[model samples]
Target: MFVKYCTTLFAGIWLLFIADIAHAQQPLPDKIAANKAKDWQTYRQASIADSKMAVYFRALTSSELEAINSAKSNGQSKANSKLIEIKSELTVESSIAGFLLFLQDYDKIPNWLDNANGSQLIEQITPSHNIFRIQFSAIWPVSPREMLIESRYWQDRQGNVHIKVEDASDHYTSHKNHIAISIIKAHWLIEPLPNDKLYIQYRVIANANGKMPSWLANKVALRSSWRTLKNINQQLPNSDWQYQKLANILEYQELIQEPTSGTNEQTKDIMPSNNAELN
Candidate 1:
């Protein structure tokens, strides 16, 4: 349900080709300022100056790179250049049967968020789809945020479940006491292994939608990724969680509507310029 906006890990980062793209274009102020770039519009779309991304990327441990590469479904897209996509998975000491319930209990998601006020279903599109909302409190220098999300759950024949969520702009508006975010893309992959355990992969690519220093953006992205995985590792098993029985999930998979956005891509253009629109 994405209470993630409040989590300390998430507050700082999102899809960021803003990496070298940001640094390469804008030189770090000789005197590091406490504020964002003087010109985010230009910083968002400018030619490379030095490619600080390579250095930052090289700083990553080999394992991190391996995971990021695994998430790429095919050749890179515009998103891969300016955004940072994270892929992480953990083994849950539970059966697929036990885990499906954990996913269904979306209301409890607030317990998993960092500083989220709460989470709940705004509307259920079908057995497999829903419009959900999360409210975030002020996270320091940034304003509090509210997000209306479109999330879909699908269970395949093998019993694996795929949950996808993204920022949705149909009925929600910024006037609702929170900054309305425009881009928040992430997916949860749950695969049931044979030995009474589950393998979970949570991959995310996002654009925080406002503005902040690129350095801050990168730091936030890395920390949030690690923290999110750690929390899920602990949260799922500890909750007195149980699956809610409904129509067979197999049926849910077949009957669910196609992704409401009508797109199955993760990297087609995550970050656009000020005048650009998200595709």
Candidate 2:
């Protein structure tokens, strides 16, 4: 009786160990599908907001002459002069799903971005809400050491994600010698595309605190936006490859349990190699 009990106990332990290994290797299909759906929705809203903002900005530009004339007649000398110095604004559009995938996998801002030296996560208030601090330095001439920036992300009632970035420190002096001199506002609309793709559009309105030249500031903003998109383009293909590999593994596991000839060998031969191909 003791020998029989020992055999049964050993068999039970062996079965449990095999079950754990199988569970670890399996991907949660339901979770992955839900995540992809959520990402698609985020990108869709961003696209609509981007279109509206573009029309509004263009109208503002066309009315610039009237604005300048009104300021001059009102004895607003400073405002009148500033109107002529206004630089062209920058805009960037991308796939929302791709950007989110890039962010989730690559959290380090400076790694994929150019002219971004120091970056750190400041706080995590909740799963969806987090604060990030970043420092940007000049690429050419290397004038200032760095510009300190703090950013926050939150979701609105419509399930849209909004991100805001602001200057956090007063290392450099503004006209009033106050920290309020350096403030920037940016908005992003993230949407999803068919076939696991995303659509992301970004709009930025910056108030440079009279320290940086308007033209130079605009260039910096444009460069930063391009760098972010370039990084996403580079990172997305790798993600697709990973997903395909997981799917293949799941298919193989299901097929092995069925009675089949050596047909599986032929299928394996036709499988494509996992190469890093970016679109």
Highest lDDT: give the candidate number.
Answer: 1
Q: Model 2: which ten-residue window has the lowest total lDDT?
A: 38-47
lDDT of 2 at 251: 31
Q: Write the per-residue lDDT of candidate 2 for residues 18-121, one digit (tens) a residue.
A: 45423422121211221122221111111222222111111123244354345332211222112111111112233333344344332466676665665555
The predictions' CA RMSDs to the true structure, in order, are: 15.7, 27.1
lDDT of 1 by residue, 1-279 (tens): 456546745544533323523332334232332222222211122112211111111122244334445643221221222344445556655544356566556677666555567676778867566887777666556667666788766554344566777666555554354665444357777676554456777656554445544455444545444444555566766656534343434222332344544322321222113212211
Residue 155 of model 2 has an lDDT of 28
Give the Cα lDDT of each candidate.
0.49, 0.38
Stretches of candidate 2 off by over 4 Å are 1-98, 104-107, 140-142, 145-160, 164-181, 208-210, 237-279
TM of each candidate vs. truth: 0.56, 0.43
Q: Candidate 1, overall lDDT? A: 0.49
**Candidate 2: what lDDT?**
0.38
**Count of clashing pairs, candidate 1:** 10
Candidate 1: regions farther than 4 A off: 1-82, 243-247, 250-279
